[model samples]
Target: MKIEVSLLAGQQLKASFADHEIISDQSISAGGNAEHPEPFDYFLSSMPMCAAFYMRKFCQQRDIETTGLSFTQEVITLDESNPYKKKVSMKVTLPTDFPKKYEKAILAAANTCTVKKVIQATPEFEVELVK
Candidate 1:
């Protein structure tokens, strides 16, 4: 899918893709109104959201109750200025009634998230000046 990104006023930006639009802006301190989350925030969140959806779908397909299922994601960086050194940690919180036998299966399901796989594959990117 091709996504078109355009600059708006000041530090605000808009991304338009098939049937959807997302707006992003810098923090107020960074000279934007902070109308929405920054672009990096969306990128950072996409992985965990994708993983959680996979976990939930796995539980649902197996008729497992997801009432208490939850997850937390943490990002660690050895140096704040170094994005390449970042490490992401994701934790799965199982419900009280979750079966012990399916523990590994559930983890495997979450690990199958497409977003995580894409990052691991290190897809190449290209940019062009469109006059």
Candidate 2:
């Protein structure tokens, strides 16, 4: 996928890919209006969001009821010196009447998130300036 990103007013940024346009901004204290989610916030959410998407797909495929299904995630930094070193603790909450047989299957389904897979694979980045 090719995503084009460009700077917007203040601390805001815009990313365009295909037919989608995503906006990111800094916090109020960071000279931005705080009108949109910060870019890093999106990064922090990608994992759990991706997992939730997969979980929903799993449930939908089985015609399961997702009326009360939910998920939560907490991002914990391992060290203040290096923010990159961190852990993501995720919780899956199923309805009280949910089928007990799918307990482990639901977790396995969530684990199928592409973002988590990519993170586990540890992708490398290459940055260069264009003339």
Q: Who wins the TM-score comparison? A: 2
Q: How far does residue 108 in candidate 1 sit from its true spot (Å)?
A: 0.6
Which residue window of length 10 is worst by lDDT in model 2? Answer: 39-48
Model 1 C-alpha lDDT per residue in residues 88-110, reported as the tens digit of each score: 99999999989999999999998
- Candidate 2 residues 11-89, lDDT tens each? 9999999999999999989999999999999987898899999989999999999999998999999999998899899
lDDT score of residue 1 within candidate 1: 99
For model 1, the superposed segments whose C-alpha errors exceed 4 Å read none
lDDT of 2 at 109: 92
TM-score of 1: 0.93
Pick the lDDT winner. Answer: 2
